[model samples]
Target: MKFLKIILATAIVLCIVLVATDYWISHKAEGYLYSKVADIPKNKVGLLLGTSKYIATGGINPYYTYRIDAAVALFKAGKIDYILISGDNSHISYNEPDTFKKDLVKRGIPENKIVLDYAGFRTLDSVIRAKKVFGQYSMTIISQKFHNQRAIYIAKNFDIDAIAFNAKDVTNRYGLKTRLREYLARSKAFMDIVFNVGPKFLGEKIPIG
Candidate 1:
């Protein structure tokens, strides 16, 4: 009985520690990013994060749609001169960068002004490569608030000045799962930063200017 009690106490403490750590990291990031467009500082480039257009149920993914819309808004407002669409292109058929490129063009962003990073398989890759590969020291990031905060945290670690332009958030059932997952992601991001985790791939330098 004593052993079981000790195990239960340890598990409870671990859970509380995890929750507190996630909350603290998230709060730190929230202070740096601009949730509103009027407050966002202009940068030469905007980093558009990628998500699949279609969910497993074949319904349109709200996150994908909202991110593209936010990127378009930033461009039309003249708040950003160029856009870097970053995402996974792990397989021939699963090209996230091209998907964002096609959608952004259709939304009226000129093709020449759009750059694609096909190797942004993870948020860490996208944020780090935005500096290392694309040569962008400062840029606006477009994504949902939770995601933007995490990305901004990563950017701050690498001395990249990044602000977020929040996309319209989905508040439905789907959003709940994502929000929960974000806690775990934030915890992992803290560990990644502590360990100085680099991107999985860093090819030759690709200048955006």
Candidate 2:
């Protein structure tokens, strides 16, 4: 009977901790959004991170495409000077940054205005790589509002000048599943930054021409 009580207590505590942490991180990310939305500078670059397209489904509106489109809009608006599409280029079979580059070109962003980071295998990698590899201490991180916040938090942690532009709202699409996943991801990203988890690959600091 005592063991059962202890187990229940532990479970309850964990649930509370998870909910509290998720709420804090989500709101923290939201706060950054509120502060930077009206102030996204024209001088800053646009850094669009990548995600999968569910290749088997032939989906058109992947989160990644939306992000790139957001960057393109920023470029067209003259809100940003360049678009640095960074993501997982982990293998010959998987090349997100290249796909992002191609899509940007297709959308009328000049090739010279787009840069790719081959080793940005995760959000942390993208943020850190932005700072160390590309020398982007100040730029606009474009993604879904929930996503941008987490990235913004990490960049600020490293003392970088990162603002987030909430990409065209993606609602009633990913639903609760993606939000739950995002909550969990934000938590993990928070821990990773706190512990200073390094990237899977730290390629040579690619110079931006």
Candidate 3:
């Protein structure tokens, strides 16, 4: 009887801790999303980080199109001058930056105004390398709002002048099940930063300028 009571108590306490930590991380991310999307300056450089795919319908994922669109909007709004496409290139077969470049070009964004980083193997790698290798201390981050919130959080922590141009969100029309995992992902992203987690791979230093 005493062991049963102790087990119940442990479970309850763990639930409380999980809820509290999740609440705090979610709230912190809320502030970042709410503030970062506004007041983007005219004529600043912009960065369009990669997503899971660049070939799915809606022309290579709504996230990719929206990111390109956001950068284009900033350019038309006179808020940015150049766009940097960064993502995984650990192997020749999996080329994210190239896909980004091709799509942006197809959308009429000039090739000369875009640069590619083929070594950004993950979110942390993209943002950090954008600063360390690409020399972007300040720039607009373009992606879906939920995803951009994480980017904004990382950028702020890294002391970059990062704002967001939220890409369009694909609805739960397919099924709400997809978003269900975001809860855990959000929590993990927070821990990833708090714990200073390193990327799966960090290739040789690439040029920034």
Please give the distance, in angstroms, between residue 100's alpha carbon in candidate 1 and its true position after superposition. 0.8
Worst-scoring 10-residue span by lDDT in model 3 = 34-43
| Candidate 3 stretches greater than 4 Å from native | 1-26, 29-39, 54-60, 173-178, 199-209
Number of backbone collisions per candidate: 0, 0, 6
lDDT of 3 by residue, 1-209 (tens): 99999999998986676666556655555644422334655435677788656444434455566676776677666676788787878777888888888877887888888888777776777787777777778877777776676677777777887767766676854324435555566667668888987666556555433
How big is the positional error of residue 162 in model 1, measured in Å on the Cα after superposition?
1.0
lDDT of 2 by residue, 1-209 (tens): 99999999998987787777777766666545622434666656778888765444676655776777678878888888888877876779888888888878988999998888888777888988888888888888888887887788788878887778877655665645677788678778878877988777666776665
Report the number of the highest-lDDT candidate.
1
Winner on lDDT between 1 and 2 is 1
Instruction: List residue ranges in candidate 2 displaced over 4 A.
Output: 1-4, 34-39
TM-scores of all candidate predictions against the true structure? 0.94, 0.87, 0.76
Q: Candidate 1, residue 151: CA error in Å?
A: 0.6
CA lDDT of every candidate: 0.90, 0.77, 0.69
lDDT order of candidates, best first? 1, 2, 3
**Ranking by TM-score, best first?**
1, 2, 3
